[model samples]
Target: MEVIVDPINSAVETLMSGTNTLFILLGAIMVLFMHAGFAFLEVGTVRHKNQVNALVKIITDFGISTIAYFFIGYWVAYGATFFSGAAELTQNNGYDLVKFFFLLTFAAAIPAIVSGGIAERAKFNPFLIASFFIVALVYPFFEGMIWNGNFGYQAWLEATFGAAFHDFAGSIVVHAVGGWVAFAAVYLLGSRQGRFRNNKLVAFAPSNIPFLALGAWILTVGWFGFNVMSAQTIDAISGLVAVNSLMAMVGGTLVALMVGKNDPGFIHNGPLAGLVAVCAGSDIMHPIGALLTGGIAGALFVFVFTWAQNNLKSFDDVLGVWPLHGLCGLWGGLAAGIFGTTTFGGLGGVSFLAQLVGSLTGVAIATLGGFIVYGAVKQISGLRLEPEDEFQGADLAIHKIAASSMDD
Candidate 1:
């Protein structure tokens, strides 16, 4: 009887571990699918001649990002290395390995975000080199500091502010960092050749509205996995997170429709803006709080994007990534502290002061790292296509094929 009981207990433990591994694997796949969303979003936004380049850049960046993260970035973030025998690597149902896959998707998002901002004119291989360094070094550094408490950052925040900084998903860690880093790249690359003429802005229409809408739809569906799976285990999954994400998405959609005056681009991106903001607080905030946070983000995107496109002459961000991801992400980070308090109908145990400091710290690190990586790459290899190449389009110039050919 004793022998039978022991065997049963061992089997139970093994079953639980396997279940967790499967859960995380599915989540990783969903987030991996979001890269397609990123690709299509950029492809639809850029001009027709550059569509192939957009598709190529996103998939290539993911490949490079995986190599960088698997060999270096994961170690930098968690101090865990996969340099082990297969038997050892397969222990615990390979949950650790699957976890690495999940986080790598997040890290890869940095290049995908930047691709949109610097689309049209950026040199292909040079930007890929910058992406390698960013994923391997810059992103994982902040990820470790916040999520793992690598130094004493979380401890210090809790002691001084009455609570640790809380980012349930990665509003500050992933989105804001990706956004600000994109701002740096966009600034350094400067406006496209015809983006400004005689001190006035020029508008470039999207190549395909249906494709843009499709991209938005895919991201919206995949985001549930992004926000919910950050739990990293089945036992911790929350209905609250799902509900809050829904509310925020609706809020963003309604506001963007009104504020953007029914513009198709804004309409599609509104839900994405809302999702970005809700990622931080989705687990803790009440649905209403999430709604307000999303609504504000939607309005912010429309107004800021319009103003920047018309007024900002120094840089051209084709996708308006800074406003949609960077600024909205910063707001989401702060909103977690505001809405994730008992006073605001949340579970509490978050500090506004800690959130502010943490949010600002992420922005600073990303900005400095972006400039260093991109600036150095620019100095060494140059950042953009030649004038002749620009006229010919990246597909023909770099890839030696257009997205479509009349002869074919």
Candidate 2:
């Protein structure tokens, strides 16, 4: 067969062909591996008896998210919009399907964050049901309103503030949403047994710091795709995004070492803090700015984690999502406003006030939304496991299998 192609048409066709598609596919694969990292990290942080339960929750979330996101989540989130200049794109049904698949992977990541919070004690059936609600209904609603252009508060902000809100990689949309959900789940679940006694918090140390470290490393690698792939437009911006991500990770690790004084937990979490912090501005900030953002994020994680452990009461956030994702995501959003350069499309040349407002808005919406949804769920069916189940270990109580027993 002889192929005939116009020069301009051929160029555009090539841009959308083999190379770009492969890059997108590779990015998806990297993000997918992060689920494994989450499983290891959650299992390592919880009691040995609860390891299987935590693992099951992680696996179940990944599976459920894939299906939920494919069905209605993708369409609702990215379907149509007259705002953010996405009206034209959404008008055509054909292109909507393409955009749906491209964005669904990111949507799936939100529920994964919620999984860690409900670990160790949540019933698998309820957790699975929640996963569907988060990905299919909850997550898509937010994604549609914020990033999708037509439905979110961003359009109002753009109209009222004279500039659009920014979230280069989903600092607010993905991380904050997940963190809020985690907070709600933990709040409803209550403190683990003996976590608070005589009005003092008891620490439950990580069982395998090595596993946590390994998981952190894997997540760090996967984050490159998470941030860079958001550009959609392939160019020098992608390379810059990759570089900024690496530098931020380095900065975060160095900051952790300086503050932690040889604590493995600090080292493991530092890189994650950096990655999350940089996500909001990875494509817009200078390399030096990326480093500073990461360093601050690392420091924040160290401080916040310690504070939550010593001062916080009644809540045990098994995997530290609030500090890692919630706090750092906030930092990223604000940093994009402060340190972003005109060399890239950032706040139309940077506006600290604007960035602060955007970050704060994201935080408020995510937190309130989470509390409402989780509160309703609690009222209806209750969110936590039975106290006896918690004491006996969720694996045996809920799944009727123990980690050791499985091996035997």
Q: What is the lDDT of candidate 1?
A: 0.93
lDDT of 1 by residue, 1-408 (tens): 999999999999999999999998998999999999999998889888899999999999999999999999999989999999989999999999999999999999999999999999999999999999999999999999999998889999999999988988899999999999999999999888888777777788999999899889988999999999999999999999999999989989999999999999999999999999999999999999999999999998999999999988877889999999899999999999999999999889999999999999999999999999999999999999999898788998999988888876
Off by over 4 Å in 1: none
TM-score, per-candidate, Cα-based? 0.99, 0.88
Candidate 2 regions off by >4 Å?
1-8, 11-15, 80-102, 342-348, 406-408
Q: Mark the 10 consecutive residues where model 2 has the least summed lDDT.
A: 90-99
What tens digits encode model 2's per-residue C-alpha lDDT throughout 26-57?
Answer: 66777777777877877778888798887788
- Which one is best on lDDT? 1
Give candidate 2's TM-score.
Answer: 0.88
Cα lDDT for residue 244, candidate 2: 84
